[model samples]
Target: MLISLSRVIKGYLLSALLGVVIGSLIGMSRTINELLLPMITVIRQIPMIAWIPLIILWCGIGEESKVVIIVLAAFFPILVNAESGIAQTPESFLEVARLYKLGWWKTFSKVYLPHAIPQILVGLKLGLGVSWMAVVASELIAATSGIGYRMSNARSLMRPDIVIVCMLVIGIVGILMDKAIGIIFELFTPWVEKKRRD
Candidate 1:
């Protein structure tokens, strides 16, 4: 369980960071977005589990394969949401930044980032969920240790109680991770909460 949780956390964080950066760049560049969108759409249409066989062949039935699967599963929703968030930045905000003669970095940090926070958080939440699912699936197929592996072993022995226990652990851990992200989101975007109240 701990091993699986670690994989999910690490994969989720890295994928979220990469997705946001790449998505922001693409969102800010119409030509790049247009060039990449079709390919991205095609890749996203492929189910995460479907990649398992190829990932195993490429990475072996090891921790690396599980992590790779988790990362891939977590990446796409984040990329899509981050791109949409940046693209949806208000024109008024851009106009104000231009009027202030803000540099690109300043404009992005002050205007674009704040405007995109909610959507980014939404993406992160979705990514985290997918990461959990991916890690479990990967573990069931390939791992030597993890909640999924334990459950699989229990199934062979017909130990339904152990399987149930593993399921509960996964569920609890997932809820904790999600709540932790929610707390961080609220902490970073207090102004959004305040505005909502007003």
Candidate 2:
């Protein structure tokens, strides 16, 4: 279980970091969005399972492949949400920044980034939910360690009990992770939550 959790965390962090950076770029720049969005859309159309064969071929069903699969699974949700949040920054806010004679960096920091924080948190939650699924799927397909591997091994040995235990554990852990993200959202974007009461 610990092994699986560690691997998932590693992959999730990598995907989140990359997704935020690239998504920010795309959201902030029309040229970058035009260049990347179509290709990204096309790739997103492909199902996760469909990539398994090619991934196995390239990454050879090892730890690398598992992490890659998790990254792929988690990336789009985060990237899309981040882009939406940043790109949808109100023109009024931009105008205010302009009136204040704020530089581009200051404008983004003071205007766009704060507006996007809630959306970014939402994306992170979604990404984390899928990360667990991706790690399990990838591990089931090919892994010598982790809870998924243990479950697969148990199944081969006809141990339904072990399989059930693994599923329950995964569920519990996933819920805990989701709660953690919620706490982060509350801590980081308390104003957004407060606005809900109005």
Candidate 3:
């Protein structure tokens, strides 16, 4: 039950990218934080499956619903990580940037993002795992196609082996996806590697 690598990569990238965008907005804006804090808290408290009924009602078991579900699962982690990472950037670094007469853009690109790389990746990793699981949850509840739906069909057919195989497929794919992201992060963020080594 191997899925195409291209499709898997596309799904992972799309979910992570969308999650980062929303997370960044949420992390940066006091107004949004105030508005969404309660909503996010509530959503976080509920299991991903709890939303399936409502999602189905609104999106009709389509791709939109599944994407929304994954987004919901993914967005919070990336946002929280990025915000915390940015916040954690040393005040000393800010001062150094200012002393250098660096513009806001330069300061962010140089002093902020590099320092935040580890934390940002942490969030991305967490969000990706959650999104993968959320995809299965969404498929199990609503979608006609997906590994989760496949498992469900197997159960209906009383084929325990098929269910086990599908579960293995999801697990292996999820692990490989996370590993790929980790490798990419390491490749792109040598500063993080140096810090860890030190």
Candidate 4:
């Protein structure tokens, strides 16, 4: 569990950072959107499972391979949602920024980023869920440690009870992580919470 959690956390953080930065660029710059959107769409269409063998070949079925797979599994939803959220920022808001003579960085901080936070959080939640699944799946296929490996080992020993226990633990842990993220985001974006309450 610790091994898997570490990989998931590393992959999740990297993916989130890349997703937000790249998504913001794609959303804000028409040239970037035109250049990258088609390629991203094509890559996104190819399922992650199909890439596993190639990834293992490239990364040698080690921690690197597992982390790479988790990153792939989590990156797209985050990128899409962040792009959508930033691009959906109101034109009127931009006008306000311009009226105040705000520069690009200031406008982004004051208008675009704030508008996109909620959607970005939604993407992060989705990414984290998929990341958990990805780590487990990759570990099952190729790993010496982790909850998945423990389950696989138990299967060979005919310990069905351990497998069942692992499954239950996975589900519980995933739910807890999801709820924790939601709570943290609600704290960071209090307006979002107020809107939900209303």
lDDT of each: 0.89, 0.90, 0.75, 0.91
Tens digits of per-residue lDDT for model 4, 54-147: 8999999789999999999999999999999999999999999999999989988889998999999989999999898888888888889998
Clashes of 3: 1
lDDT agreement of model 3 with the native: 0.75
lDDT of 2 by residue, 29-128 (tens): 8999999999999998998877877898999977888889989999999999999999999999989999999997898788988899888888999999
Q: Which digits, one per residue and each the tens of the lDDT, describe model 3 over residues 73-150?
A: 776777778777876778899899989999867887898788888888999888877877777777777767778788
Error of 3 at 139 (Å): 1.1
Where does model 3 exceed 4 Å of error? 1-12, 25-39
TM-score for each candidate, following the candidate numbering: 0.96, 0.94, 0.85, 0.95
TM-score leaderboard ranking? 1, 4, 2, 3
| Candidate 4 positional error at 142, Å | 1.0
Superior candidate under TM-score, 1 versus 4: 1
Q: Could you arrange the candidates by lDDT from highest to lowest?
A: 4, 2, 1, 3
Model 2 weakest lDDT span, ten residues long: 47-56
In candidate 1, stretches whose alpha carbon ends up further than 4 angstroms from where it belongs are none
Q: Which residue pairs collide in model 1, if any?
A: none
Identify the leading candidate in terms of TM-score: 1
Q: Could you tell me the lDDT of residue 122 within candidate 4?
A: 89
By lDDT, who's the top model here? 4
